[model samples]
Target chain A: MGPATQRVAGPAGPPPEPKGAIMALTQASGTRTEPRRPSRKGTLTALLFLAPFFVLFFAFTVFPVLYSCYLSLFKDKAAGLGLGAVQKVFVGGENYLRALTDPAYTSSFGNIAVYCLIYIPVMIVLSLSIALLLDSAAAKARGFFRLAFYLPNIVPGLIAAVIWLYLYTPEISPIVDAVKASGGTWDLSSTLAAYFSISNITVWMHTGYNVILFYAALQAVPKEVLEAATVDGAGPFRTAVAIKARMIAGAVSVATLFTVVGAMQLFAEPLLLKTKATAITSTWTPNMFIYDAAFDKHDFGYAAASALTFAVLIGVMSWAVTKLGSKADQ
Target chain B: MRKIRKTHVVVAVAGALSAALLAGCSSGTAPAAQSTRSGPVEITFSSWLKGSKQVVEAFNASHPDIKVTFKEVASSKDNYPALTNQVKAGNAPDVVTVEYPHVSEMATQGVLQDISKPAGDFVKSKFDPAAQSLVTFGGATWGVPLDAGVLEFFYREDLFTKYGIEVPKTWAEYEAAAAKVATADPAVRLGSTVVGDSALMAALSWQNGAKWGGVDGDSWKIDVNSQASMDAMKVHQDLFDKKLVWADDDPVLQKKQAAGQMLSVISGAWYGAALRSSFPDQAGKWRVAPLPAPTSAPATAFYGGSTFGISKNSTKADAGVKFIEWMTTDPAAISARIGGTSSTFPINTEANAAAAKTFDKAFFGGQDIYANAAAGLKTVPSGWTWTPGTPTTFSKLADGGAQVKAGKATLSQILDQAQDATVADLKNRGISIK
Candidate 1:
């Protein structure tokens, strides 16, 4: 994975690994922790297992991405509906500049900025509250409630967005009709309003998965520590927040990192809502904007340029998030 | 030791799975385009047209040598992008429908083959001159003119009569009627803009002599937010501000049209057919007229139409041309297309008249709606070409319009940004935008 990553910029390479080479070396040495170095035969066996993974990994993920990076550097020059042979010119940083200045590309990033602002903290808080409730003695039918909460997560992102789009639409949605009947508005007309409407779908679809993770982390907390806190006359709420939440800080930080990454790649929900919400253009997210450039616009060079620049942006963001998350762990 | 062995086995299994996937992916070879020893050579027609299969069936019933099949690219919104991808991948359908806005873009991007050698003479002598001008870019013929989506005024006869409004022949009169009708009834609307369709705005601007995008000498000229466009936008802004036209750009605007609450629309001839199907209850209440012009000049705009072309990757270019030749000029092909569920105004002059003959009077209260369309066809403004970045340009324009609807930006401000953005976008694509 490390070699494959070096070959192409991975959009997500593991948030905790500050420098991949150091991480790999430490792991290799620490795993066989002994006075003697690991045998050559042991290394050969590991290589045999890793070789196939590297081949597939490089062929699919690394090659296409690196090729995209390569393609971004060149420009296709042809004349008159391009009748003659295509002339390829290498214009090193020009495509990157074009993407940076492009209103369509830049505006899509703004849409993500709005999405991340509202979705992340709200989702984390909701999932944590639900997980604590389920872990507490007050909650009955724990298994059934957990299953019901986790059910929406199992639905594919595309299907879930489609289901929610129908529900968001005023003419079809009974919820929307009921709201309107009671003189309340569920307006998906304006851009900011539409963002909220679309953001609600992300929250509904993903909150359950986080709930399950938080619950699992709670289950792993030491029974003795929990009993000690309870025996000392700590109330359920205090024990849940102060003890259980603190114990699962590792899981919570990991979950937060993933949520930050997922929020940035938002495309399908807003894309499905395009017809229902007119403000949501095809270029509504960075990923969808890149998809249009490559496929719809057939400006592969421009699309590739945007993809590489986006990768760098994501890397920077993940780095910042990891730093912030790790400091809080202390 | 047991744990380490199990973990090693898991990694080994994962490695095997990925290796197998890689092998499976690389196994399939590219299909050879030409026939080896075939009785009938089949070609694919990729389009967004609804009932395209009927035309292919009619073509096959006559020409047994070259058979064509239909493959839908995407919905109208994503059709060009889908087509662009297929062409780039080298397996694009031989007979693909290139819409007017994408005609120049596709050609310049090298998706289309130069049809000048095979069907150039046939296209020039048979198709309308205006349609010819659109397909021929960079001094070479590129496509077979399938249809012309000439814009016309479709209004409700009963509403106009009830409001004491005569059929408007000029923009000033049209505005007056819209104001009068809206004032007469609070629930009623004059019309609605196609919120998702930038072509509708471009079509109106075309009528007002806005050279939104075109080729001149060797350089491309794209004037999306020019003074003429401002003139067109100004009129629409007036209508919208005064509540003369409903600001509802929803697909649900069809609901208003069905109920006869919306009085009129200035859309392509295809939109009239849509009324026949989508709003059958409004039958015998609607009528057609020439598009209201700014001056006394008889000018209309082109909105939605497809131009059939052979893909550059097709091995059977000769057979492809033969199919296109029949599809464009032949009477049988024209009738099948005109009768289809989502057909447009026929591009062939004679076909236009012939299709007009087949118009059902029951739908339009015995009004010859196609007759108005036929007359308007003569006035569809020409010399307006498209750029490769047209889809991006349209998206920007529509987004800006959405912003205006949200009251975040003024019409002039948004449009000025759109024009400059379009020039930059085209230039960045290595296109000559001067």
Candidate 2:
């Protein structure tokens, strides 16, 4: 969980724009390969130019991902004095089986599933509506509102979690005091309160970035199309919901995918709130589970096994999302 | 998958080249460290102890030939795992600090340098009997004894007087006192234990002479959730159910204790110093007593304790031993870490008088903490060996304990889960569990 993802999570107000990253990557690779087909010198020049990105991509992303999977297949075995020598035994699928069977590991996914169930719908509606409101006549100080709304997204995710954690703590938090002042008790220590407490953080950190996206999409909508609709007796609500939202369906799809992925990797917020929120455990989320395994438990094999599984799951989910989006377009 | 397979062939060649380069460095360092031909020997010490730097510096002052640098790692529970990773990565510190509960795991796993040939004599002669007893497993002393982590009760004297609660000398008395305190002030309780903190519970189990984890012939035995552990668990469960103790610790408990909302905290002497900084206002109101046990036996649990070990990867064994010898023997080193703040309890019997002389009684309302701590440390029952998978076991138990508190499971089920998880983890790590 980070503030940077806030700016990355959504699509706003207009018809979907062409997918930005894939277009850039394909164009970069295609143009380079298409040129210099027969000449060795030309090919060498192109290769030299593209070397940095490929080398970095392979080393940081490709190699580690592959190596991590390789590590999962072999577990470290202690012999003699616990540290005398560590033997690497190829346990194959044992780590995976253990992770799958583990209640802690399985429970993390359960937590995230419940998190997304609460987060996605509320996030989508609130951001989309906020963007539409800004686009309509009622929202004045448009520039100020845009900045003010997006500012929460700018707070680093860890810092944002910390800030909200303080706001959650009864002894130190003014928010808790406010609730008490209102004759209401907010026991964030409970399981349900802790879940919503973290969900609120994810929403707070993310909603504005999506708002900005929607607002930008709204701006991109053809003025003539909206004017024509209004001339035929369409109101602001109809223009926003019927004409505008469908136009930005691609953006909405992208945001939904990001939300799903973000929901999957939930870690920092829950971890930071763990002290005040007793229900949040060491293995509260999949990321936390991986951290506990690799760092806390020192079982790298089990950690890598679970990590690879989670990675494959995300990859499949993203692909399915893209496939579904394309079919919707057709 | 096929494409990545093809890429792996090319990557394999690159990996071999890197491996060769790494081997080159390792071989070079080994020979250089083999002889006294080199200048002053240097070794790295990794510990999370608060004043480890001062202790190391004191060692450096005494032994000019051995220049030791300190690398501060995480707290006790996290330190071993991090050190294990470092050792596996082949970039380990020459000297590593392991805690009481993890000593056997480290010792038997063969991760440490066998100093028997060189430093064993020094350890047998100089180390504290208890600390020495802890590190000796499977026929060798794996590390140097550092300090005592004996448990003690730090209670608010003023609160006890106000509530008219008697000083509890037994578990039953402790419960009665808790009940009295809770009735006197509904806002505060006598104490609170973190539901997820299996470390505290394990230590308490140790007081009952529970062999929760230990080596069994050629295999490891994970006997948590046994009669002894269940005995300790019963006390904690009673505390939780009766609303006599909180399910939290300092910072969270700090505010309550500072405001007299929480009356006492029964933990190791190391935590006593923490009280001064966290709640300086509560001074002169608090006092220290030996932790209560069943039947007034004066038995105490060891908590948050550590020992110093030399890594097998270190070629400088003699230098490492010399440094450890000085740290354990020198009153100056122990004195540098004197008081509860720096984690000093004079595990070295010789340093007791000096440590007691430098002891700061101001924090504990003039209570002779060192004297009482010595008495408590004297009563720690032996045979409380640790398994390498203590952290693994505790993490599960911690989560399981939370589940129990949440009404998702029962305490017995959680302990059983801890036992099963410990066994599975030990097996995974190649610790025989048959």
Candidate 3:
């Protein structure tokens, strides 16, 4: 069967290829004696195989991104009490200027900056430590523990935030009750408290998934190197810190990169938490600013401009993270 | 070769899958064309109000020529985004539910159709002038009013009597009652701040003769932090400062009520039904009264209500307007809605008796809430027009309220901020502000 049929058949189908053969096949193709010429018939076949993906991708993704860019240049202008027909007036860079100048929109960047500072380090350290513990030889029930650690990631992020919202609310939370009984006060009414509460949720939901990623990278370390370390009188802690961690530095860097991007796109958690926490405003994050502009204010042009600006910011941040990550890996 | 044949099969499969996807995308547009030639003119109605399904069923069962398909959406805050998105995507329902405050904004944005030709006369003749003013803007009708949420005070009779606090008649007495409740028990509060509900805050301001903004000749005027508005807001701020009320949304407020920590709530007439559903255990203890006025003169304002508008993209505007008319004015539709325990005060004067008859007053301890609502409705000051930047105004006000709650700012400062932010937003949107 062709690759399409195999994919459609899913898990019930026979293996598409032996796991190890993929590596050998790539090597074989790379070391061909002569470069094969692309025949017109072969090119036609390749295009036919790629047609569906290109069509769906262009329809859903590329067009919307381009259309939003176009929409960002023009705004709807109404006259005479705004009950008459509206006109789309093109004003280049004006929307972007407005978004940049608005204090609420600019402050949202500060909110996410603080959020990333707390969320990223805590997530990386906690997940990496857990990965090390699970990878150690002394750990029992490795398979069960790995699955147990990964379970929280399986719950949708919005659902996870909702569950955490209940746990954070003062009226219904058992946590708050316990704290009060112990002569302590738990309140999420401050901006700092909201930041930590949101960070706590992201860490809880994502740390487990990162653990699995780091653990898999740790498993791939060669046995001979680890045995050599043991022969050099390296204890469990030394081996874990010096050998396994060094071996999985690439995985850790990749996880950090992903976490940075995820932190910048914080919308749903804070949006839900804003109901309970008086400190969390409608424009608490970049995405929420776009949402409030578009839906609440009905200023789609400003929303589009803010969205594009936010996208460029995210792109620059991602590039910086990748550069830093690769430098750390080297 | 074998690979060539496999590629051919893959190409065929991909083509078929894409064809299926294309078919699925085209199907949404096909029904509108088919309905034009069909037996019944099928129209889609989107609403989030209670008893919408029963009202649609009742309409469909009675009418043979027109059929309505009801789609339930989230509350107005969430639904407006979805509605506007649908309008932009060219897949909007024929009838859409919009709140009174949002009508001006939606109509100005071209999300709703100007149904002045089809249903304006009916709206003018059937609905009162106050209701008519809310729907008609810039010499055109954009929607049909369903209910008028006249402000009322909901209190627990048992708690008020036990605390020896008479129902408040003026704002001064209300403050005294709040103080009395706090002195009697530190746990119980007399009322709530409703910190995030800008609508309630606006209603309070409106009751105290605060005209936030209105059209002045050609340009729009916005005065959100007017003296009257600040005076009304400061009362609540004082209560908040004294810790005499619980500051929370409805869900948390309901929890406080269940714990017997909150004793009363100042809300719209519709909240009477909501109180029953939310606190069914305290059914016999609750009572409805007119809202306390700032002066000896009794005055109130509309708080929470919705209207039906035909989407600008709908090809069935006539059918949609018919459905809206029936839903808003017909006794049968009123009965069906009230049967679901919706205590909405219908804006149609003729349908008020029908709705009042159908509503279960036993939930409010047999108190005649309709008479109180009618009294409250008579006192709603006129000449208060909603601006296109009202949604932004409310959101900013709510944010300001949050700041006040956090002790970073006061209510008066937030009012100024809300006013300045709304003016800036309007100017950004190319709307003229005076």
Candidate 4:
């Protein structure tokens, strides 16, 4: 059992030393002998575990990113009327500076930021609240409810966008009919409507996964702590706020971090929604602009540079969230 | 002891999981390269052709020496990036579909091979000069023109008969027809309403004697606010305000246009398939007619058609050109594609000869729809460039138009906004548009 069990546990799983013993001893004595160093054999085994990830990370993520950084420095040169002696010439940060100042690019970023403001907190609260409800319920069908809540997350984001787009469209949408029958002309093509429309799609598609994550974290909170809170006359709401809430902050932080990163890569929803939201441009999001630059404009070098810069921006943002979230948790 | 064993099992399983996933990904891409290696000089061709699967299939079957595998690229918006990236990675397809708008940029990038000399026979007599002109970037023919999709006005013949309205021959007559149609049915629209400064409006403007780019051809000047185009826009705005057309661009608009809800639709020759598919009940009630002539001239305009170019990086350039020539010029192949696909008109004269005999005029109330299409095909004037910056520039114009429509801004302000945006977009792409 010891050998087989250790093998099944991930290479980065907890060490053999008892966690409780180590914590207690460290607190009391304030010092302890170091555990045995991982052997060369163990290091080799660890590399075996790591090799797969590094290969893919290098091939797909690292290479393209580095290549994009290299591409950003040049503009494809055409000799005359864009028809002759073609070559690539280094233009040195020209693409970057232009992208930064471009009205379309700036506006797209602004629209997405506004969309994130509406989306992130609402998604977190609703997802966490539903997860808590499922966790606290005494019904035996809790598993079924869990599955039901998480069902929408299984739908691919593109498919979800397409479905919502159809529903938002005025002519054939049943939703549109309802709006019209009630003496309301709900046009999702309007600026505000487009914002809400895209946000609603993100919430619908992702709320379920967030619920599952929160539920898993909620289940990990010790029953004894909750029982003690109950014995102390702390009601469900009080228990949730003071005790259960703090216990699930880890999951909440993780979910929030991911949502922020994902909001930056907003493409498929806006691209599909363009068919419905005539007001919504194909380059309404940053990723969509990158798409336009590469495909529509045929400026691959500039597009590649923008993508690399975007990747860096996302990395910084993700790190900021993780750092801020961890600080908030503390 | 049990805990330690359990942890080890978890570690092993996790390791195995990653190993399995890595293996899966590597194996998936490996086959793509391997299969092409063993094929009969495999020439990979890509197209954003959702409806031309039969043509692709015919090409694959009829040509055994140069096997052409057609990969359906879902959207034109995403296709070029994938193509350019593949080219950068030294894995470009042997031949790729380059839409008219991107032909200049692609040829400018030196990524498309020169098929000018080889494709001369196919280009000169077989295809229309205007259609051939689309693929001729940098004075060398880079691709074979596949279709000539001229924008024509399609209307409901039954609706015209039912309401006692004649087919419009002039812009004023078109306006009158729209008004009459609107008066007859509250639910019905005068014609399709356009959202944004789309290519359709540009075509209408061209028909109205406005050039999007400057006439000098060296500098940028938007004719977006040119009197003629502005007049066309004003007409659109009036129709939209009158509730004669839906002021949206949703798929539901296609459904509405298919039904009798729309009296007319201004679309390319390929719209016949859409009308048939969406409203089979109204199939025998539709008819094709020339675009209502503008005051300047009695003329029609072309809309959308993609061209096929051999990638400059392709190792099998000769084989790829052979496949393109075969696909574009073969009488049997084009006829099969046009008849099977059901709306696409072959650009080649030889192919048109084959396709003309096989038309289902029953779909258009026994009218010679192809002849109507062919008549307008001659009127398709060239010099309509679909610049790579067009999407970016026009989108900004659309955004500005949205603001103007909402009364948040003036049309003049929107025009200024669009001009600045278009110039900036061109500059960003490193194209010197003054």
Candidate 5:
């Protein structure tokens, strides 16, 4: 049955009329009723709108992770000059211990942690400040600025890496020569240089995107509040700080979280730069290291172990981001 | 307001149910296609051919009784694990391409069918012995010697003529000639070797009588830290010290080699095809000659090549053998694949001769590369084998060599460390070290 019918069936339907007025008789017809239970039809319509997103989320995100976790427990074994029998041994927790104790794995983790510490705060502040300027300005060509900022994200990651690789290369790179000409040596092949160079590429590529987001959020803030603040004694800077800026703490928190996750999973930059940089070992990043161990070294058990450890680390960090960012948003 | 509240309750319940159903549907997508087909006599053939579809189509056309399919694997490193997993799961390809350096690695993995007796009748006389020996490890013949990657010097005749210099017949003369060419124009240098390619290094070292590992009776002993290898390392050190070679690692070095930026290149027989294909305009300006010897001995060794092996998990193991036997043992298949394409020298002796007859001598400035490569193929010695752990060991050695090259460590110190590391790595991998 429809929700409207169910509500009318409840007790205490009509109110008492005032005696003297005939016009009051129409007012006495007012009904009192209880809330109706939701109908099945309404629930069905709501579900129809939500189906697509949940389908993708479970397929791509959930299943493979569980499968990999299962595979991580078994070790592949070959017997007798590798020309005899082969077997899979299930050794509980052994693979994880081996991965944890591996120097390559530990070193890669340490490298990523240091990278995150340097990159996250710098990216967050720079992007936030640029976003604020772009938001606060009375620029006429807002769309042009938005497009200019988002252009880097459109460039394929591999292509960007290849272009940056050449620019960083000292052999044909005029940029390197320019640096040297000014009494500075810019070698992107060293440990410190590789980190800085990769960070620069990340900042150049992503800062524009963050700017677009911050501007969008700023535009959503109520204009009257900012106008009132400005009408009082507040200047543009003070108005932004007192009213509009406080409105984008949520956006800032979200951007900071994204930067943290991206920094931890740094792969393409390090991978492309590996041949150029002597210091960038094959295992310079955890993902690359796991890949090398599995494919290059042909040690799947070890690779799976390392990958699971990496996943766990990323999981913890991602959880922390969501928790802290959402709490701060509230 | 009551009706609205009732609708909200109804909507939320429906929403939750659909979410659960959608999640259920999505969770099973990747795992849905789990079982292999049951009806047809299906066989998969793993190959590294750039245009493998054409080959597979051609094979399928002649043999409709058995259906054959093919897949292109990324590279040896990427292919091995998947291949191993498939084999372990009882779903391996019938035929798999086993590159020369990896034949021993694969053979040791116990996923290769031993065709020793069937392969025994194949003539050692017609093939590059070194190429054949790499596949015949641990008293079992695991592959058919598909082709030989014998090294030869590809020199620019125009540059030689411009400098009024002759192609050097020995290492000392080659150096002298390189010095002369450099003197003629400081803009150009000698040659470039992939210093990072340990296989290339091992080949050169083997030509200089360097041994890696050997089986004595029932025991295997690794000899990576031998005197001959150390002596061979000196040649590379000398080249780097003199700045006679380029340091940047890329295929552009090969392009530079073509452009006469380098006078000569020490590369495999397949290098000829690359010259003809990549630099088609500079065809007649280039000539191939046999590598110059450092010593008085007339011997050489293999640098690289691909071989074919049968997967142990294949239900069509016999059919796979028959196919590889036809490709490797039959003269027509090898001749057409190698000689007709003018790609590499076929391992089949008759096929090599046929291929040699088809080669254009004008590309080499009238030097018959076929005749030269054929001669080099004979003098090539054979004493190398792959263990499952070689890739790891080689990568480690390369890193060690890089350290030595960078002056971070002395050669002796690096070698000692590499030796210890290799032994430990092999032991850990469960390879018997004697």
Candidate 6:
């Protein structure tokens, strides 16, 4: 996961050539040279260098993942008003069956589906359009625009949600007042309005970060191809749509993948909104359902089972996105 | 042979490193063992209530034999998870503040010490029967009640006079006043419903004689959807359906309250202090009344209250009980606690006079609010036992109330849903149900 993120972030820096061009060069050189195994001493040095990451990763990530899987198979049962000693009993497949059958847990997926349907396309289009405008020659102060766009992303998600919460509050918010002044009702207490309100927060916080990604990818578009399009009677709009957008298709797919994963893990924003929005229950999203199960109900076994189920769903979605993304790139 | 030796050396180094990491992570403060060798018995107290620090200081000053270390935690909603986690981790404090609804839940989960032997007699003598019932569950005294949050009606005196409305004395009259206020002005509401305050809803249900759940001869009886509970909730649902009351979480509720568009609030006795502090400009306009009941008999229930319980992990149970009894019963401790903005009605009858003397009644127009609260406290119905899955039951109730606000479901339906959810949860925990 760490190395994959680094690879994705690699294009954020200025490169002398396009990533595709660099890949082609590497591939050509790879056919000319014979692969050789490193010596035992070299391998030992590499292991020494990687040891810290491996240790921390296993302790923090791998161990908990495996432990939760083990815990999900057992449950704590206390008899007759639970005053006596509690006992941990192995209940194979029961926790998972209960999680699947529970309406509240299952409905949380429906809530996430609504959130993702609204969040993903809006985020992708808004960021891509802003990146295109920033890349155009007619746009002014590219550096300032990029920084201004990325400012909200730098603010932590919790802090950003809090700031947006203030704006969503009717008594204190000038936005709500302005809407009311114009004879419009801005009600966030309803379920559909809450979905839009939460999606608005995520979009505000993330569009700028993806704008930078798309902007960097747009920069790597071969200048000759764009110039050739311009010479062939193609206007800037046509050239941008036909040449630049196609070149950065890979970046768009990556952005969509991240946004989909993010939408599936929607928690902090809706959880904060739950304080004010009556429509958002404690189990508004899958993550919130798992959290309420573990902490509020003290049903760690059920929480673990639901969490593992959600993880598998996310894994399959991510894999499908990657497969389709690569096919689109081709 | 050389490759095997290298592999063995690598494995040994990794194992040693991981073991060291695990040891470092697991090293925490050891539980204080029985204080036989101590010059003074040391115990840790954790609370988030206002004036707790002052009370702890008073206890430490007066009691030389028992030394207390106080830790300020977050409010109850955020504190319970941390408290239970600490209990599970075996490093919980000696004494902690838990609410009435959570006492049974925590006691049943083995997070709290069964203090029957140490504090049972003292609790029976010092506290009233209603307060005593709140702490004693399943034949064991789990905690000592610090306050009795007797439900009360806080209304705008000037608004009621201007609107020519009488102070409601029954549920039927309250509904009439709600409709009258709506007719007088669509913008003004007689009161508001707190859709997310399951405690407030539970108190309302209790006033109507709803026994949510209780232990019945070693088995639990789950009855959240009783006739009384439905009748109590139907009134709120009717007001919500007619838009006569504002949803408490709506920002407009605050706006209306500040602008004098909202006429009343139904909450515990502590809310008088909150109102005075929150709306200082409307200080003289507010008055307190006993909560209107379904009948004229004047029944009430506790809205919000805290109790002190010793953690099961603490070995210093006696020291912890001494601290709790002092905090709840000692007049000096009660006075110190009321020296702040807190208006908690102490369950200890003897300490009420001390609390009233320090509490400034100038906020409620010099009305003897404590006397009014005491009158209401006497009317609280008993036999309302909070079962083991209170956290789940409350959240479901709150969610149902939310659905009511969203116009998605009625309160009666939500009550039935909560009843089913509670029964399912208790059954899942392997608690025998009748």
Off by over 4 Å in 2: A1-38, A78-84, A101-103, A189-191, A328-330, B1-38, B74-78, B107-111, B339-343, B407-410
| 10 residues in a row with least lDDT, candidate 5 chain B | B28-37
Off by over 4 Å in 4: A1-53, A135-140, A216-258, A328-330, B1-44, B48-69, B75-78, B120-122, B125-129, B213-228, B315-326, B393-420, B432-434
Separate DockQ for every predicted complex = 0.21, 0.33, 0.41, 0.22, 0.17, 0.57
TM-score for each candidate, following the candidate numbering: 0.85, 0.89, 0.91, 0.82, 0.81, 0.92
Model 1, docking class: incorrect
lDDT of each: 0.77, 0.76, 0.85, 0.71, 0.69, 0.85
Q: RMSDs, each prediction? A: 6.7, 5.6, 5.2, 7.3, 9.7, 3.8
For model 3, residues B165-227, the per-residue Cα lDDT tens digits are: 999998889999999999999888999885667888889999999988787776688988999
Q: Give a tens-digit lDDT track for model 2, residues B172-287.
A: 89888888878877888988864667777887888878878666566666798898888777867777777788765345666787778887787887776777777777778889
Clashing pairs in 5: A38-B6, A43-B11, A82-B108, A82-B110
* Worst window of 10 by summed lDDT in candidate 4 chain B: B26-35
Error in Å for residue B299 of model 5:
3.4
Error of 6 at B245 (Å): 2.1
- Residue ranges of candidate 6 with Cα displaced over 4 Å: A1-49, A325-330, B1-16, B24-36, B248-251
**Residue pairs of candidate 3 with colliding backbone atoms:** none
Q: Of the candidates shown, which would achieve the greatest TM-score relative to the real structure?
A: 6
CA shift at A95, candidate 1, in angstroms? 2.4
Candidate 2 lDDT, A1-330, residue by residue in tens = 344234333333233657997799888988777554566455555655675577668667887888798999988887533534578899989999999999889988999999898888889889988988999866799999999989998788789998887787776778888989999977655788778988899889889888887788677778899899899998989988898888777667667766787679888888877766768888899999998888766678899999998988888887776676565455
Complex DockQ, candidate 3? 0.41
DockQ measured for candidate 4: 0.22
TM-score of chain B of each: 0.90, 0.89, 0.92, 0.82, 0.83, 0.94
Restricting to chain A, the TM-score for each candidate equals 0.82, 0.87, 0.86, 0.82, 0.79, 0.88
lDDT tens digits, residue span A222-286, model 4 = 89999999999998888877888787776576567668778778898888887566568767888
Give per-residue lDDT, candidate 5, residue A175: 84
